[model samples]
Target: MECFFKDPCFSHEEEYRVVFFQHDIDHNEAKYNQKVLFREKSGIITPYIEVRPLTSSKKLPIQSITIGPKNNVDNAQVGLEFLLIKQGYDSISVERSRIPLRY
Candidate 1:
Protein backbone atom coordinates (compact mmCIF):
# COMPACT_ATOMS: atom_id res chain seq x y z
CA MET A 1 0.00 0.00 0.00
CA GLU A 2 1.15 3.54 -0.80
CA CYS A 3 0.46 6.73 1.14
CA PHE A 4 0.91 10.35 0.09
CA PHE A 5 -0.56 13.66 1.09
CA LYS A 6 -3.51 14.96 -0.98
CA ASP A 7 -2.32 18.54 -1.10
CA PRO A 8 -0.04 19.62 -3.91
CA CYS A 9 1.38 22.50 -1.94
CA PHE A 10 3.46 20.25 0.24
CA SER A 11 7.00 20.29 -1.04
CA HIS A 12 8.91 17.04 -1.55
CA GLU A 13 10.51 17.60 1.84
CA GLU A 14 7.20 18.32 3.56
CA GLU A 15 5.50 15.01 2.76
CA TYR A 16 4.25 12.90 5.61
CA ARG A 17 5.74 9.50 6.34
CA VAL A 18 3.82 6.22 6.37
CA VAL A 19 4.45 2.55 6.96
CA PHE A 20 2.37 -0.53 6.09
CA PHE A 21 2.25 -3.69 8.15
CA GLN A 22 0.93 -7.17 7.46
CA HIS A 23 0.11 -8.31 10.96
CA ASP A 24 0.54 -11.90 12.00
CA ILE A 25 -2.02 -11.86 14.81
CA ASP A 26 -5.25 -13.69 14.09
CA HIS A 27 -8.19 -11.38 13.67
CA ASN A 28 -10.39 -13.62 15.84
CA GLU A 29 -7.97 -14.02 18.71
CA ALA A 30 -6.94 -10.60 19.97
CA LYS A 31 -6.27 -7.00 19.20
CA TYR A 32 -2.91 -5.74 18.06
CA ASN A 33 -1.17 -2.94 19.89
CA GLN A 34 1.95 -1.31 18.56
CA LYS A 35 4.07 1.60 19.76
CA VAL A 36 6.21 3.34 17.20
CA LEU A 37 8.92 5.95 17.68
CA PHE A 38 9.82 9.01 15.68
CA ARG A 39 13.18 10.72 15.89
CA GLU A 40 14.40 13.98 14.46
CA LYS A 41 17.64 14.96 12.78
CA SER A 42 18.60 16.80 15.95
CA GLY A 43 17.45 13.82 18.07
CA ILE A 44 14.10 15.15 19.27
CA ILE A 45 11.44 12.44 19.39
CA THR A 46 7.74 11.66 19.02
CA PRO A 47 5.59 8.59 18.53
CA TYR A 48 2.74 7.68 16.17
CA ILE A 49 0.82 4.50 16.74
CA GLU A 50 -2.30 2.36 16.49
CA VAL A 51 -4.24 -0.23 18.45
CA ARG A 52 -6.94 -2.44 16.99
CA PRO A 53 -9.08 -5.26 18.30
CA LEU A 54 -9.15 -8.41 16.21
CA THR A 55 -12.31 -9.27 14.36
CA SER A 56 -13.37 -12.78 13.36
CA SER A 57 -16.22 -12.41 10.92
CA LYS A 58 -14.53 -10.49 8.17
CA LYS A 59 -11.19 -9.24 7.02
CA LEU A 60 -10.28 -6.04 8.79
CA PRO A 61 -9.86 -3.12 6.46
CA ILE A 62 -6.37 -1.73 5.90
CA GLN A 63 -8.10 1.60 5.48
CA SER A 64 -8.34 1.97 9.26
CA ILE A 65 -5.16 4.00 9.44
CA THR A 66 -4.50 6.55 12.18
CA ILE A 67 -2.93 9.74 10.94
CA GLY A 68 -0.48 11.48 13.23
CA PRO A 69 0.89 14.96 13.76
CA LYS A 70 2.46 16.78 10.86
CA ASN A 71 4.34 19.35 12.90
CA ASN A 72 7.44 17.36 13.64
CA VAL A 73 8.23 16.37 10.08
CA ASP A 74 11.64 14.78 10.65
CA ASN A 75 10.39 12.82 13.61
CA ALA A 76 7.52 11.51 11.52
CA GLN A 77 9.94 10.14 8.95
CA VAL A 78 12.01 8.48 11.63
CA GLY A 79 8.90 6.99 13.17
CA LEU A 80 7.73 5.57 9.86
CA GLU A 81 11.13 4.05 9.18
CA PHE A 82 11.24 2.58 12.67
CA LEU A 83 7.78 1.07 12.25
CA LEU A 84 8.70 -0.44 8.89
CA ILE A 85 11.76 -2.09 10.39
CA LYS A 86 9.80 -3.47 13.31
CA GLN A 87 7.23 -4.89 10.89
CA GLY A 88 9.99 -6.85 9.09
CA TYR A 89 10.79 -4.53 6.25
CA ASP A 90 14.49 -5.20 6.79
CA SER A 91 15.90 -3.46 3.78
CA ILE A 92 16.11 -0.11 5.59
CA SER A 93 18.96 0.73 7.91
CA VAL A 94 19.23 3.26 10.71
CA GLU A 95 22.38 5.31 10.17
CA ARG A 96 22.67 6.17 13.83
CA SER A 97 21.23 4.37 16.83
CA ARG A 98 19.08 6.29 19.26
CA ILE A 99 16.84 5.03 22.06
CA PRO A 100 13.10 5.22 21.45
CA LEU A 101 10.83 6.81 24.03
CA ARG A 102 8.61 4.32 25.91
CA TYR A 103 5.72 6.50 26.94
Candidate 2:
Protein backbone atom coordinates (compact mmCIF):
# COMPACT_ATOMS: atom_id res chain seq x y z
CA MET A 1 0.00 0.00 0.00
CA GLU A 2 1.13 3.56 -0.66
CA CYS A 3 2.07 5.41 2.52
CA PHE A 4 1.09 8.72 1.00
CA PHE A 5 -1.87 9.26 -1.30
CA LYS A 6 -3.58 12.31 -2.79
CA ASP A 7 -7.36 12.31 -2.82
CA PRO A 8 -9.10 13.74 -5.87
CA CYS A 9 -11.83 15.26 -3.70
CA PHE A 10 -9.24 17.41 -1.89
CA SER A 11 -7.19 18.43 -4.94
CA HIS A 12 -7.36 22.10 -4.03
CA GLU A 13 -5.46 21.48 -0.79
CA GLU A 14 -1.66 21.49 -0.96
CA GLU A 15 -0.44 18.31 0.77
CA TYR A 16 3.19 18.01 -0.10
CA ARG A 17 5.24 16.30 2.61
CA VAL A 18 8.69 14.78 3.04
CA VAL A 19 9.21 11.44 4.76
CA PHE A 20 12.44 10.57 6.55
CA PHE A 21 14.19 7.19 6.67
CA GLN A 22 17.26 5.65 8.36
CA HIS A 23 19.55 6.34 5.40
CA ASP A 24 18.20 9.88 5.13
CA ILE A 25 18.90 10.44 8.82
CA ASP A 26 22.41 8.99 8.54
CA HIS A 27 23.43 11.73 6.11
CA ASN A 28 22.69 14.49 8.63
CA GLU A 29 25.17 13.52 11.38
CA ALA A 30 26.50 15.90 13.99
CA LYS A 31 29.88 16.19 15.70
CA TYR A 32 28.17 15.79 19.04
CA ASN A 33 25.96 12.86 20.09
CA GLN A 34 22.87 14.89 19.29
CA LYS A 35 20.39 13.48 16.79
CA VAL A 36 16.73 14.21 17.45
CA LEU A 37 15.23 17.31 18.99
CA PHE A 38 12.15 17.06 21.19
CA ARG A 39 9.45 19.71 21.18
CA GLU A 40 6.32 20.18 23.22
CA LYS A 41 3.13 21.34 21.55
CA SER A 42 -0.31 21.39 23.21
CA GLY A 43 1.32 19.56 26.15
CA ILE A 44 2.40 16.73 23.86
CA ILE A 45 6.10 16.11 23.38
CA THR A 46 7.35 14.82 19.99
CA PRO A 47 10.76 13.99 18.58
CA TYR A 48 11.85 15.91 15.49
CA ILE A 49 14.56 14.34 13.32
CA GLU A 50 16.74 16.28 10.92
CA VAL A 51 16.55 14.78 7.46
CA ARG A 52 18.27 16.22 4.41
CA PRO A 53 16.64 15.43 1.08
CA LEU A 54 18.55 13.11 -1.20
CA THR A 55 18.90 14.95 -4.51
CA SER A 56 21.44 14.63 -7.30
CA SER A 57 21.98 18.37 -6.99
CA LYS A 58 22.52 20.39 -3.83
CA LYS A 59 19.27 22.37 -4.34
CA LEU A 60 15.87 20.91 -3.56
CA PRO A 61 13.97 19.33 -6.48
CA ILE A 62 10.95 21.60 -6.13
CA GLN A 63 10.11 22.91 -9.59
CA SER A 64 6.90 24.71 -8.71
CA ILE A 65 5.66 26.48 -5.58
CA THR A 66 2.06 27.63 -5.25
CA ILE A 67 1.06 30.47 -2.96
CA GLY A 68 -2.24 29.71 -1.22
CA PRO A 69 -5.10 32.22 -1.02
CA LYS A 70 -4.24 34.74 1.67
CA ASN A 71 -3.77 38.46 2.18
CA ASN A 72 -0.70 40.06 0.59
CA VAL A 73 -0.20 37.35 -2.02
CA ASP A 74 1.85 39.76 -4.17
CA ASN A 75 4.16 40.45 -1.25
CA ALA A 76 4.38 36.74 -0.54
CA GLN A 77 5.51 36.15 -4.13
CA VAL A 78 8.29 38.73 -3.81
CA GLY A 79 9.40 37.28 -0.47
CA LEU A 80 9.35 33.75 -1.87
CA GLU A 81 11.47 34.77 -4.84
CA PHE A 82 13.97 36.50 -2.61
CA LEU A 83 14.16 33.47 -0.29
CA LEU A 84 14.68 31.09 -3.23
CA ILE A 85 17.50 33.19 -4.65
CA LYS A 86 19.05 33.69 -1.23
CA GLN A 87 18.96 29.93 -0.60
CA GLY A 88 20.63 29.21 -4.00
CA TYR A 89 17.47 27.60 -5.38
CA ASP A 90 16.75 28.32 -9.04
CA SER A 91 14.47 27.40 -11.95
CA ILE A 92 11.39 27.42 -9.71
CA SER A 93 7.94 28.57 -10.77
CA VAL A 94 5.81 30.61 -8.37
CA GLU A 95 2.05 30.60 -8.87
CA ARG A 96 -0.91 32.13 -7.01
CA SER A 97 -4.06 30.25 -6.03
CA ARG A 98 -7.32 30.72 -7.95
CA ILE A 99 -9.75 29.19 -5.44
CA PRO A 100 -11.97 31.63 -3.57
CA LEU A 101 -10.67 31.42 0.00
CA ARG A 102 -13.08 32.47 2.76
CA TYR A 103 -11.16 32.55 6.00
Candidate 3:
Protein backbone atom coordinates (compact mmCIF):
# COMPACT_ATOMS: atom_id res chain seq x y z
CA MET A 1 0.00 0.00 0.00
CA GLU A 2 1.05 3.59 -0.53
CA CYS A 3 1.67 5.59 2.59
CA PHE A 4 2.40 9.32 2.64
CA PHE A 5 4.13 11.08 5.47
CA LYS A 6 4.19 14.71 4.43
CA ASP A 7 4.99 18.08 5.82
CA PRO A 8 3.77 21.48 4.82
CA CYS A 9 7.03 22.25 3.06
CA PHE A 10 7.90 18.80 1.76
CA SER A 11 6.28 15.48 0.96
CA HIS A 12 7.37 11.86 0.92
CA GLU A 13 5.33 9.13 -0.75
CA GLU A 14 6.35 5.49 -0.82
CA GLU A 15 4.85 2.04 -1.02
CA TYR A 16 5.38 -0.50 1.71
CA ARG A 17 4.21 -4.05 2.17
CA VAL A 18 3.36 -5.66 5.46
CA VAL A 19 3.03 -9.37 5.92
CA PHE A 20 2.70 -11.62 8.89
CA PHE A 21 4.75 -14.78 8.73
CA GLN A 22 4.31 -17.93 10.72
CA HIS A 23 7.29 -18.76 12.89
CA ASP A 24 7.74 -21.16 15.77
CA ILE A 25 8.07 -18.68 18.56
CA ASP A 26 5.99 -17.20 21.31
CA HIS A 27 4.73 -13.65 20.76
CA ASN A 28 5.37 -10.81 23.12
CA GLU A 29 3.65 -7.47 23.55
CA ALA A 30 6.95 -5.65 23.05
CA LYS A 31 7.68 -7.31 19.71
CA TYR A 32 5.90 -4.79 17.55
CA ASN A 33 5.47 -1.08 17.53
CA GLN A 34 5.43 1.68 14.90
CA LYS A 35 8.96 0.64 14.00
CA VAL A 36 9.48 0.08 10.30
CA LEU A 37 11.92 -2.17 8.46
CA PHE A 38 12.70 -1.41 4.83
CA ARG A 39 13.58 -4.27 2.52
CA GLU A 40 14.41 -4.51 -1.15
CA LYS A 41 11.86 -5.76 -3.66
CA SER A 42 14.36 -8.51 -4.49
CA GLY A 43 14.00 -9.71 -0.87
CA ILE A 44 17.48 -8.72 0.21
CA ILE A 45 17.57 -7.18 3.68
CA THR A 46 19.51 -3.91 3.87
CA PRO A 47 21.27 -2.23 6.72
CA TYR A 48 19.42 -1.26 9.86
CA ILE A 49 18.33 2.36 10.01
CA GLU A 50 17.07 4.61 12.72
CA VAL A 51 14.74 7.38 11.61
CA ARG A 52 14.54 10.40 13.81
CA PRO A 53 12.10 13.24 13.42
CA LEU A 54 13.52 16.67 12.88
CA THR A 55 13.16 19.19 15.64
CA SER A 56 11.48 21.61 13.30
CA SER A 57 8.44 20.68 11.27
CA LYS A 58 9.84 22.31 8.15
CA LYS A 59 12.53 19.67 7.65
CA LEU A 60 12.06 16.30 6.05
CA PRO A 61 12.46 13.12 8.04
CA ILE A 62 16.12 12.17 8.47
CA GLN A 63 17.57 8.74 9.02
CA SER A 64 20.77 7.82 10.83
CA ILE A 65 22.54 4.49 10.33
CA THR A 66 25.15 2.26 11.89
CA ILE A 67 26.29 0.14 8.96
CA GLY A 68 29.08 -2.10 10.23
CA PRO A 69 27.27 -3.05 13.41
CA LYS A 70 24.49 -4.70 11.47
CA ASN A 71 26.62 -6.65 8.97
CA ASN A 72 29.99 -6.97 10.61
CA VAL A 73 31.35 -9.52 8.10
CA ASP A 74 32.69 -7.18 5.43
CA ASN A 75 33.82 -3.59 5.33
CA ALA A 76 30.79 -1.37 5.89
CA GLN A 77 31.36 0.75 2.78
CA VAL A 78 32.02 -2.28 0.58
CA GLY A 79 28.94 -4.11 1.83
CA LEU A 80 26.78 -1.05 1.25
CA GLU A 81 28.06 -0.62 -2.30
CA PHE A 82 27.43 -4.31 -3.06
CA LEU A 83 23.89 -4.13 -1.75
CA LEU A 84 23.16 -1.00 -3.75
CA ILE A 85 24.55 -2.50 -6.93
CA LYS A 86 22.49 -5.62 -6.45
CA GLN A 87 19.39 -3.49 -5.99
CA GLY A 88 20.05 -1.66 -9.30
CA TYR A 89 21.09 1.63 -7.84
CA ASP A 90 23.89 2.76 -10.14
CA SER A 91 24.86 5.83 -8.15
CA ILE A 92 24.73 7.15 -4.62
CA SER A 93 24.97 10.63 -3.17
CA VAL A 94 26.53 11.34 0.16
CA GLU A 95 25.81 14.62 1.87
CA ARG A 96 26.91 16.02 5.17
CA SER A 97 23.99 16.91 7.39
CA ARG A 98 24.68 18.44 10.73
CA ILE A 99 22.60 20.30 13.26
CA PRO A 100 24.03 22.22 16.12
CA LEU A 101 23.17 20.98 19.58
CA ARG A 102 22.00 24.45 20.62
CA TYR A 103 19.83 24.78 17.58
- In model 2, where do residues sit more than 4 Å from their true spots? 1-15, 19-51
Question: What's the TM-score of each model vs. the native?
Answer: 0.24, 0.55, 0.24
Query: Please, what is the whole-model Cα lDDT of each candidate in the order they appear?
Result: 0.47, 0.72, 0.41
Candidate 3: tens digits of C-alpha lDDT, residues 2-98? 2334333222222233345323267553554334366684588753345444656633332332232232334656666676567555455322222
Model 1 ranges with Cα > 4 A deviation: 1-69, 91-103
lDDT of 2 by residue, 31-95 (tens): 32266678996699976777566876766677788887787898989999999988887678888
Model 1 lDDT, full chain set: 0.47
- When sorted by lDDT, best at the front, the candidate numbers are 2, 1, 3
Give the candidate number with the greatest lDDT. 2
lDDT of candidate 3 at residue 53, scale 0 to 100: 43
**Residue 32 local lDDT, model 3:** 47
Q: What is the Cα-based TM-score of model 1?
A: 0.24
lDDT of 2: 0.72
lDDT of 1 by residue, 1-103 (tens): 2354443433422334556453555653233333454556557675556545367633332322233434554786678677766765546433322323333
Highest TM-score model number: 2
